[model samples]
Target: MIQNPFARFLTGFVVAAAAAVLPVAAQQAASKPDFHQWAATPPMGWNSWDCYGPTVTEAEVKANADYMARNLKSSGWEYVVVDIRWYVGNDTAHGYNEKDPAWNIDAYGRFVPAPNRFPSAAGGQGFKPLADYLHVRGLKFGIHIMRGVPVVAVQRRLPILGSKATAADIYSKEGQAGWLRDMYTVVAGRPGAQEYYNSLFQLYASWGVDFVKVDDLSSPYHKPEVEMIRRAIDRSGRRIVLSTSPGETPVAEARHVAAHANMWRTVGDFWDSWEQLKEHFEVCNRWAPYIGVGAFPDADMLPLGRLGIRAERGDDRMTRFTRDEQYTLMSLWSIFRSPLMFGGDLPSNDAFTLSLLTNKDVLAVNQRSTHNRQLFREHNLIAWTADDPATGDKFLALFNAQDQELAPASEAAWASSIITRQTPGQSQPVDVDISGATTLYLNVRDGGDDIAWDHADWLRPTLSNGTQTVPLSTLPWKTATAGWGQVTAGKSVSGADLQVGGQRSDDGIGTHSNSMITYALPAGFTRFRATAGLDAAGAAQNTGGTLQFLVFTQNPFRPMPADSVRIPVTLAQLGLRGPCTVRDLWTGQTTSGVAGEFAPYVRRHGARLYRISTARK
Candidate 1:
């Protein structure tokens, strides 16, 4: 309801008047595309790729646009992008079809929306109607494109708009994308190369395109075509925000990439997997310093809510990430100043997904916070900090990368698991001291992604008190619970021989993730040991079943603190002083005190974002 469109209109009028009176060079200089102004904050919106893949229908796009306007537009989520292969009318599920693909293009070597797929383009209208449809609702339209001329265009040697040369004059057969045959590389500085790019952007500007994601141009650091696209956007005289795509984009080219595009991907095709989420913790930190130079490091789409309804990866279902992991994804991306393009089908979004997208205070950090960086990454506990530009308060984010409910939430765990998702399905050594403990709890839980088919095993289990040793399975377990089938003693969850990595074990226990088994230990038991791994039966499914292990002296099934993962640190540890007020934005709690050590807790895979400001007496 705010006057954002009005402000933009007013700014345009002022700029136009100023340009009229200025010299040509000055006006041109002022008109150059400085992308920072286009997306002052990280861009947020929805993309079709995750939910509908290359086959997103116009009706579906409209439904999502309607949802965003009705629910999320006021939060500054405006750009609705059609991701990848919109021109391929015959595209099928799980993958793009290269055989006799129904391609759509104009006479001038430019790809257009397929008329059969995009019904509005039945009479050469091509996305203009769809773009206009969004514009009227106070939303912006965007589209995805590969960074070269269509192969059919190059084969036919189609004419280049606004230039004497044709598509063949500017293309190369080398260095083409392995996955798709849609495009051939357009050589840098070749005749009509710039013109071909210029014509594309000019056509897009005419269609009211406000953003474009140019793919396959960043991972190998295709500097030439990237610069040409940057020039083309600037030359079009429209403020279309340029974003580069599909990265693990060489961190070496960080400087040049930031200067040219509004946002570049830091990692590639992030799905709702704990492995991907675990890796991004390191990737985000490395790219933090390069965030604010007129651009951002895109952490790719939020693979939250419902997904894979006729898409590339999974069957139609809700996101694979656990609820707490969903929070972790949002917290990391926001605090790192990465663009958030929600990848779910919007109309299908449940209330929880809607809540994730609409939190104002969290979105503010992505938009306006400064000096964002990793505070620490000690063991599996990681923290990130950023500064509020307006209030000069510090924003702190604490995360527990451990899959199980580890501490500072419970400082008394017999063993706290860490770094298991790194090389999943492999056995990890577990050794914990249990001297004087009457009972021992063995636990396994999902690593914040999903619990489907996560098989856990305790191989070669033993208890040792120096000279004497005992097989853990020999001891009668007091209680056993598994997320799936019955927990088994000295066998697989299905009561088969204890096996992992195709090897059998004579002594162990097997269970599924989100499971726990407890045992009453005899007096003088000094230590417990096991080699833990995913049973081969579960690993063979390749369902990305990740699990974490834990050893606790007390019963872990009891209710933990509502805020479960609290880490204690002094004000000095956060570089602060006396009389500081800390606010948990997610919890909506304000703690006012002359603080020493700050102990903030969140449940498993949950994050606590603290806003610290000086308190007045």
Candidate 2:
């Protein structure tokens, strides 16, 4: 059962502060001041997770920090973050050390950096020496933490710094992170819960830390703890930027997060894969409107340059994205203005990767653009736009979410061309013109009908070119996306017989509502013939199953975009229909006197970014 996030803060659990140990320095720090002002813009930085994983040493961090301070510092990249597992003395790569985990903490029930890994943290000095190291070099330091008090701290019944209660008094087993077993949730409104958090940040404040990324708090969206952390940071009397992570952070909590964090992740840990990057086009768009003055929607780290040397996910190597795909990643992230956190090892950057990072023109959009949003997505073609308030110009990003070599990565690709609704036991013949079509898409939409129990299938689907006929089942679908379960090639979504109308067949794609199956057309195929209906499993009852069938001559965002059209991006679409000159950001070329449409040429799985300076009409 889902626990109410606010229940821990209930009236009965409320514990009034005894005003014990509120530091004198904290009293003057003005914790309640507008935190949004501390981070007027999204924080740009380098992080250690992608390259070093849990095993990054002090030497490696300083190397990357040195590289950034000398190279990317002038470009507004400042924060140097130490990601997860910093307190584990013997942390390993590819994930956390679950069983027999080694830990390091000070007597005050607060975690300190592992001295074995981060040598400067030795002698109980904590991160002050390292933080000072970066500070002197004109860089800010940040660290990642799991939400709540350390389990070891609770096990020891360590004293809470500002209150009489011990860690054991405030912690409950409720809502713990499933993946890691290092921490326990601090029950809100209980004695010492808030004080323990305040004391934790007070130590960080003493170390001069500028940023803190709290993980496991956002995915399940630990609301009470987030509020507690916010209060704790304020009470610590330091201006620290707060970020939340490991997302698809429920969009339902947008307002709550925007009010609390400097940035919150929109998707799960993004990697150097086309599929992961493609998923962001939709996720970023959905969270764009919630971006506020202090809070930005993060698209996770840029997985470029040398990675996985000792990281959690992959083996050590340069990023796997193509040059075109790399361009698309940067363009989309910039246009959306998601807080730019470079995740790869910086010192190992090759020429192309360096070019991607140091490109001033692109970085400007992320730093300065306003009113950004996805303009529209037609077929596999997508566009996002943002405005430059200072210059009154427009920043446009046109994305081709198609990849010919790889399957389209969209979860549910949508387009409406030919549409029909099927009743519970309805059977229908499908015939569609396939003349000169590069690809054909068969879709089952949840629109205009109930979504539950929407079992569907194509039976004996065939293609003919007036002379030769080919069995549709003879070739596999180029790309398949499902809504409920996996799309079965010659069986039902459940991998059973493709039973439609009480008849079982084995020669077509079986899927559910809100599904799409894409097939690359044969060289001379002119017609597609098939029989479609609700699968016998869902149609058996005939009470709540209703689905819409639609076909498209174009791709519904198949990674292969050979048939995808270059959508005409008209000035009228951007609400600036007059004359303007558009400059291509990547090529440094300008097109003058552009009037109606300003369609920039974008490649498959790539993007085209433009800066449009409108002329007065």
Candidate 3:
């Protein structure tokens, strides 16, 4: 059974704090270090675990890095982090092979990159070459490591660098991390323990690493090891952002973690599931007080787009979340100021997936907002608020927690119970009335039954003083159609066309030969279009055996027209008095014109994305 994160944290924090006592001056100095200065804003990047798992390779990392540099770098997406077990040579797609293990270590008992997987690390060269390559491309590199000294170091009794005591002298005979089998905790204040951690960061700094995500450290709240790691990073003469992981990190240790690390996981490994996303609302709310510059409570990675392709936990396929849920995930993470890490195969991202990453307006809320708080929650309906630091503009987010579609009547009832700012903690029933409002925004979950936007049902809002009903149908929304690629000849292809299914001969690097499609969009188009098909029948089943519609302006797989489309609808039709700029949500480009209709060509199972914006002069 999973233990309660808070209870476990409180218990561990008390015990660890009591056991690790240092000089009063030293403890105060350690706590006062300016760790938050490294990450002034929540870091946005891509990580490997959600897609490739233990089987990720140097080439794959470079491919993702190239993608980020080319497409996402301009938007402040920087870090390219390799997750756990990079030092294990025998690690495969499924999981680690412990019985026939191959360990990579230096003479000083520090784990090094497996030379087989990272050829640059061969002959004593660690990740220096890879880090250099990333730096040249204007990207930051990161690596994952577990807490404590390697068990092999202890067993081999290697001498700790710069210390007379050996690894065995510092290793604790009791309390190995429960999940990882290769390490043993180092006893705090041991003669060689500090030197051991120092040497580890020294090596990392030599390699030009910008981030270090230490796992198995937060849940048990190993105070001593955390301090040791912090001290090592400080002494390395480099600025490395520290991230603690494998959480539901105890809420009780918020301040402590913030002082020691840049970002800490507030939940366990998140996946493409609605249940997990729902649970984050409460967890984020509980940890909201601890968020600030450099100290972010991570919501884990965004498991959007194509994930688990040859990953350890599951099979290769697209994510299981619906388009609506994906939007909700992005909205919640941004408003709460959680670190945004994309956890899908970057090379295989669809246009819609790329749009989700490139949204500048949404990303601003995450990168520049302040005073984030959960304004109110009523049963399945939840609301959040954040203020833009520069302009003091308030952004509000409403969430529908229920799985099924909420009826108009029920929406009004729920909206009525939302007590406004004045009536804090008390609900006074009021009817929602959004009459004569110049601009109305509707947060609708679905496109009406057909492609038409005018037929959507409205959601009523309950305010402190009055109530307002907003028509969802009148709001600008997205519409899409999706289905599975038909199986052919014992195989599966992405489009309606079916062909021979057997695998093709490998192209030397373990990939099968396959056909590719490329297309461009027409000018003055409002509809977003995309096509999703499986590479193989087996991979399709691993991905829920269905096609998902996602909207994007630029075609993800091919070049598309860059010309802007003039939507013909007038500002009056959209409840606006002045001129409005129609923005393409996928490309983050704006086209100024009267709102009109433009039907863009869409391939079967494709998607389209668009939104309207108006500036008051």
Candidate 4:
């Protein structure tokens, strides 16, 4: 009975087919070469990008690894990944010197750890020494690499190892990525392309690397290169986990990605912001059907705790997310079963942040859960449900996406309406009724170009009976200052600075501009549709702005008014029946109830996790 159109479509074919074919698929998946042998569960680890960016030094990597070994290793956190441009000798905390990178390469054509940055990698030892150091402490080592053959190798015309062809012979001129200029893609069928990949993995194996996060290969999904990497890893006699990055990876390529890479990113470089976090709910849902065993739809790194100490984008500071939002982020990532790669400076973690990372009961959901899906999403309210395969416990996560706080208020005085809907030639406003209903839903549709600058279509309808006005700029829309570069590009750019009304300001950027507003409905209505068009003077600028509204409603099942309330669970909600025990995962407290609700207060932008277990009669 999910109201969302996409959810209803998914329920029909995807869910039904999954139930019928999963057992066999699970069995065959286990036998696959890139299955759980490398990552039995979603890889739990620490990545350095959020803190140090591309300039993380040996000391920083070691400090984080040491902290993990001493503190977090026992709780399943292991990999110490040094991310991006590590070979660039002149790299700084701000960004990398991509053009004049001082890459460490040997006579053939594989990148090695820079000795000046990683002192232990001196004397031609490569990362073997550093990997050995981490291995001794019961940890693993990882490094980031851009997909394709190094451009320098092609310039030098280095011979491909174990092959007659040179790097130039196998490299494609049209295969270079737009962002990184150091590499060019390998033509899959060209002679020595597979051999070049084999040599690269062989060198990485020699360095004892346990993980390789390959970037620029996922957003467009370089299938040929992925297959080459997979083949190379198999031939290298190493069990390295291959993680694809900088994504919104095409969900249609799920089978190819699953067969090759251990994990694939579902979003691009996740940071600490509510706008990015809210965007993830949709991305994760699209990729949720693909998660299993070793093949994880990575939600990128967890940008928690203290971040941007020396990051590429933004100044040094603690995460901008509120405490409630942090909890919500963690809960969503856990229930979705995305790989947990903490992106903060591990050595600088405070006790509260550490508690969020080390929660075993909550971690169990990420490590062991099945049939994970978005149960319902109404306006700013979202819910996800999953089941523990070992035990028949059910886990439910509810999220409130609005920026405003949810509080008790009188429903009788409230009225709601559809503010305005504009298309190329039409604009209309209509009234809605919510007198007896407990939920309200808002659906925003975008008919503009689907380029990086244009925002994606977002729908956030919630059950409600009261209303509050919210400012357009105050909503969690991505905004940027004038001088801000394209570091966090794409739909992340907020259209707030553009013209708002139908009139254009003398700002010299645009012509006609459009904006959205939220209004209250009258009473006793369920749904409405709206359309809008955007026009900008410049080809690259966005002409539309986003707006948000708030509503207050009591939990219909529980009918209680407090920060916390217990609502009874039924067979319909959990897909189970009879008496059940509700245990708060965070508080470690239990309440005996008959397949009913458990009480826990969810913070603003935060979440509460519970283990609902049926009682054996």
Candidate 5:
């Protein structure tokens, strides 16, 4: 049961002594705090939007708490949150909620905790009892709230705590300013405004709230509200993790948000789509450098396994992602260090979905690593690599995002130049070859803001002798946008396994069946590359391979496949060093060469990789 006295504490500005008497250096030093140091710690927790919706109940919250303690505590997942409309709602008997008159009493426009929902939350002490309960069980408690000062505060002329101010004095005289009028705009620097913000934090602090996720703060450039909230939270003397919600914050604003809030969203609500996944993959890689401890760039929720439980406006569809795609999504998110807030109903978790969530290797990448990867997509495939600074292990993931199963002879599209062309008036392509791809590893960061990619063309090829680099200007350009399309190319490999767990029954290593590793082994191989697809003309209905590669072998990195195919390769048909092409990232170039010595073998992760040694053209 949640409990906390509903009270508001207005923030008051403290006037510091004049700094003119101090040394200039001391003044500057005084102004600087080790914000990065404060944020280095990893955040752990579970959100309520998954299992329960707006009508979340105390009994269900307790059950979730019990589950976290028994199964996920050691795994560092804590924080039992009651998400959305907790104050003005009641528990739903079935899967969805019905409005109950007993729960109809509204505390102004602010959705204060409803007594029917939390019987123990006496006297408007919304989440205090639950927070205390979680604390006793070695867990933490959190709740969700919408942005802006509550509308009830304005109507009733509620007195702000810790000051002689009223809510009406704090909110902007202009009232709501955005298309969304759900929250009243509270301008910072307005009389009693800081105090109003401070009072809200004081209430949470008194309630023992460890986390507060505020919605509607990102869309309207609510920097004033955001800044005031930060100051109030800091002044509350309690360490509360602040999370902003609902939309993508611009790259320029990422640093600002990082300085104040613990996390910010990087995209609109993420559902399940191969194209959305691909777009998100590209976006995550682009922002990897900005992420660090404390501040995280949220990629939205993990709508995996199950979805559409709340007022969420999607058909209740089981995820359409293939097993291979699920693996790709998890691996990529883990590598990019995005938050893994599952959106599936917990009690109904299937064996396969549960297994996917609990995979130790996958979780390690998301929570333990310290570095992140940079990715480039060409043709129907994406190339990803992260370097481990500690052990020098290079993690790599290859994805086939095309709609059609690719044939052997089709031409692969190049995505290496996509980044360069994103800038206005930059019509030319880059120069480079994809042949020099290597096994670079990376460290994991909590937020996605610290990661930065200064220049798209700065990537240097990891090439061996005779590796030809192509300039970008030579290849023709094609445009792309959201939805209703397929990218295709020749027969391709999908996914990678950095290290093979062990030998398996099918003579492959992936957990699922049919995944095999492909590679073009070279004598003293320092550099190797392959080309697949970036764009396709028409859609193929699960017919051909969504070309991808996965690595299963550690000592010798190998590419894995979701399914197997018989590509007839006879030494008599083609001399050693066969004809092949690979995309280049640094210059956006694709160079063709003869195929190399080919021996087909399935590695771990049920995938295969083909090593194509290029012959002189």
Candidate 6:
């Protein structure tokens, strides 16, 4: 799960605090003045989870913090977050508060920092030293926490805030009464419940904390807790910016989450994958409207460049995304107003990767552009419009996620096309003219879509690892076909083509002996198509008995173009006794009927000629 680092810490703190004694003043401080005005704008910066996972150390965090201030601060990337457990060392035999199997905060769980790890903090201080050090450096500090009161609080028979209450008195025995059970449940509006929250934040506020992320408290499931946590933060009198996590924050609950949090995860964990990135495009579109001046629908962290672990038993090192796909991921996220949180290792960042994260123009969209929602999604393409009110100029992003690659990444490729209305009603054509900015900017490296400026015709291609920025006019779209093939082959690929009314052909499209004839299919598809085709040695490949059929959609979304769905049919199924008919799925009409189309293997690769036509009545 992609968690807000600060919230993850708070989860542990909440668990531990139930057992620790709190002074009476702490309870009063919990209901004090508001704490949000401190974070006038959304917080920015890098976190350690995408790189370190449960084993991150103090030295590494400090290094990342140092790097952010020295390099990324000018780009508006500020917060330096240490994610997950820091209460216990890698060894569990130690006094770590291990809990339910699902949320253990030890190794294989969230790790707590061993006293040996950070000698500066021993007496339940947690990240106070780190937080104070960051403050001295003119930077904000933050940590993560899970939701729900801790089970430990219940075990100790701890004193509840009001009327000398005990833990058993507050916990809801009926699971249905609350959403979470891994942690002790708190009854909202109870005499001591508010005091519990107040006391939690009071300790945090005194610990030099500037940011608090409260997790598992989003959505209708935890509305009451969300409100209580927000109140607690405000009352603590430490203007901390609240962030919520793990997404699924429904539209109806947007107003509530937005009111309390500086940011909330809009989707689940966003890994570095073309498929995941593509999925996020649709999800981000849905949550964009909730993003505003002080609050953002966090798209999660940028798992770019380098990730995983090292040493004895580590994770795989290969990048989850291609250079081009990474560009698309960043561009879409930036244009959508998602908070920019780098999840990769800053200590070992490559030059190319750093460039992508630190690009001035791209960062501007994420940090400065006016928030905007998606305008439309069709033909597998998604487009959005954001107007810079200060300059009265609109910034539009047209994305083509179609799976098409022309050639290898040699140079930046450019495609000039019309952005016309789907339905013919406008007097002016949506011809993108990037002819005006003093310095034309394009994030060529972030690949799913190409960025063009209206005033400046020059579009630069940036490599994903952030390596090179080549002019688009100089690159070839030929390598683009590769991306299409990959997309159709992704995990989400349904059947590429299906032979309706059953029969196969031997005719194939765009297939030479040199190119492999492969097809994508849905999970339960049981049909195909075949056409006449010759083999490598000029020998005919005949459809004898039962050839397989396939079906799938076009891989990448091309910007505002006709959507293509691939269908394959087998000659045996078509029963090609007469003309074999191809039908449309939406209209249920035969597309084409041909006689004596007796063939073996017919594969129409990237079908561009077939139109969505109706059959004769």
The CA lDDT of each predicted structure is 0.80, 0.79, 0.63, 0.67, 0.50, 0.49
- The reply for model 5, stretches above 4 Å from the true place, is 1-42, 90-111, 173-181, 315-320, 404-617
Q: 22-65 in candidate 6: lDDT tens per residue? A: 64544544444433345544567877666776456788878888
Task: Quote each prediction's TM-score.
Answer: 0.72, 0.72, 0.64, 0.73, 0.59, 0.57
Candidate 1 lDDT trough over 10 residues, lowest sum: 1-10
Per-residue lDDT for 1-617 in model 2, tens only? 11123312211112212224555544444335567777767789999998988788888889999999989999889999999989888887866787877788888788888888989888888889999999999999999998989999999999998799999999988777656778899999999999999999999999999999998887668899999998999778888999997676788998777777778888656778675577678788788776666677899899999988988665788888889899999999998888888988999998898888888899999888888889998766899988888888888899988644322223222223322334434657778887888888887765343224566788899999888889988887878876555688788875568977667786888887667788887788888888877776555421334666777776444353463347578898887855898998888899888999876567788888889888865
Error of 3 at 7 (Å): 24
lDDT (tens digit, per residue) of candidate 5 on 246-343: 65677777667776777777765455655456567667865676666666777766766665454233344456566766766776676677767666
Q: How displaced is residue 451 in candidate 5, in Å?
A: 23
For residue 492, model 5's alpha carbon misses the true position, in angstroms, by: 39
Best by TM-score: 4
Tens-digit lDDT track for model 1 on 361-387?
A: 888888888778898887667889888
The better-scoring model by TM-score among 3 and 4 is: 4
- Which candidate achieves the best lDDT against the true structure? 1
5 or 6, greater by lDDT: 5
Worst 10 residues of 6 by lDDT: 450-459
Task: List per-candidate RMSD values in Å.
Answer: 10.2, 11.3, 18.1, 11.1, 19.6, 22.9
Against the true structure, candidate 2 reaches a TM-score of 0.72
lDDT of 3 by residue, 109-147 (tens): 999999888998899999999999999999999999989
Q: How high a TM-score does candidate 3 get?
A: 0.64
Candidate 2 clashes between residue pairs 3 or more apart in a chain or in different chains: 94-312, 403-559, 408-558, 408-559
